[model samples]
Target: MDFYLTALLQGLCLSGIALGIYISMKIFNIPDITTDGSYTLGGAVTGMLLSNHLPIGIVLPVVIIAGGLAGVFTGLIHTKLKINPLLSGILVMTGLYSINLSIMGRSNIPLLNYTTLFDSFHFIADLNWNSLIVLLFIGTLLILLIGYILKSDYGITMRATGNSEKMVSALGVNIDRIKIVGLGFANALTAVSGFLMTQFQGFTDINMGIGIVIVGLGSVIIADTFINWMNISSIWISLILVCLGAILFQLVLAFTLSIGIDPTLLKLITALFVLSIVSLPRLNLTRN
Candidate 1:
């Protein structure tokens, strides 16, 4: 029970990134590999601040801006230089490695002795349950914000820009600017995940974000799967499912580990699991 609950909390910590992926890949039609770099940037910033005894409130905005700038550069490069979306993301992600290290002044920062975002809550007697409550509160707030944005006129324009860039541009929307904001917002959310996870896990590691995008992709894929299967069209419900999908992804990993799989094979398991999720939807089409 504790094992699964831990997974649930892990999933909750990752909900931000999952939603970020949904925005970038599902809405913007861009596979933003900037996720890998921005994620660590978030953690790096959090670690650097907390190590200096900075408050969480102060740290969060800095993390968001740092992450946003990383994304802005990717979008700027992609649009102004006509670089391939993937290539632009790769360039930014590559650059963030050095930037993150420079910010932290080391490859890792341990925060076990420092105050963290999770320390403020005492609503529940059980440790894990308290964390769950905090995560739920934060997750709900994020979902509401993202959902509100997606339902707005600007969001519709953003969606249109992705669905048909030329058509949106013909209608007078600045698609380039839209892409930049979309990616910036998405990566900011990704950075928030890093912020949550570093506090949740009690340390920051330089390579922590490596391939972390796959986790978000898996969650988004699950949400997309259910959205299609249920014929759902509501953005609010879709956002909720994205958070649920993050939890489910972690639960699946927890189950896999509980079954006595070699711990060293976890990354391989993650890749195979995500590949299967990506492939299963297409497999459903074969039956038609």
Candidate 2:
């Protein structure tokens, strides 16, 4: 039960990345693999600040800006250089490895002895429950903010840009700017996940974000599946479902571990699990 509870907590923390991926993939129709690097960048920033005894309030904005800039870098490469979006993300992600390392000044930064945003949250007596409470509180605020933005006039244009770039461009909108801003928004949210996870887990490793994009991809896929099944059109509902999908994905892995799956095979399992989610929708289409 405790193991499952931990998984739930982690899933909640990870929902930020899912939300980020939701924006980049579902909204922009771009597979911004920069998520891998931006995530660790967030962790690196948080770890460096926290370990230096800096306050979370100061650390939070810096993390967001760092992540957003990384995304913007990817956007610039893709839009200006006319490179493939996927390749652009790959290049930015590769470059961010060194940037993240330089920021942290080391391969790993431990924060167990330092105070954290999570540690400051203590609504209940039970430590786990408190963490859960704070996570939900923050998550709710994030969802509301993101939902409002997506429904805004500018956000509508952003979505339209994704649906049909030519249509958006025909409206005299700067399609390139929209794409860049959208990617910036996406990766900033990804950094928020790194912020939460580093504090919760008590350490940050340079390699912590390797293959992490799949987690967001898997969660967004689950959310996409649910939206299609339920015919959900509301942005608010979709964001909530994305968060739930993130939790569900983690729960599935937790169950796998509970059933005695080798931890060494976890990455393989993650890949297979995401593959199943991706394939299931197509399989349903074929069956129909």
Candidate with maximal lDDT: 1
Candidate 1: which stretches are off by over 4 Å? none
Q: For every model shown, what is its TM-score relative to the native structure?
A: 0.98, 0.99
lDDT of 2 by residue, 1-288 (tens): 888888999999899999999999999999999999999999999999999999989999999999999999999999999999999999999999999999999899989899999787778898788899999998998999999999999999989999999988988999999999999999999999999999989999999999999999999999999899899999999999999999999999999999999999999999999999889989999999
lDDT of candidate 1 over 148-229, digit per residue (tens): 9998999998888889998999998888999999999999999999999999999998999999999999999999999999
Going through the candidates in the order shown, the clash numbers are 0, 0
CA lDDT, every prediction? 0.94, 0.94
User: Number of clashes in model 2?
Assistant: 0
Candidate 2 structure lDDT:
0.94
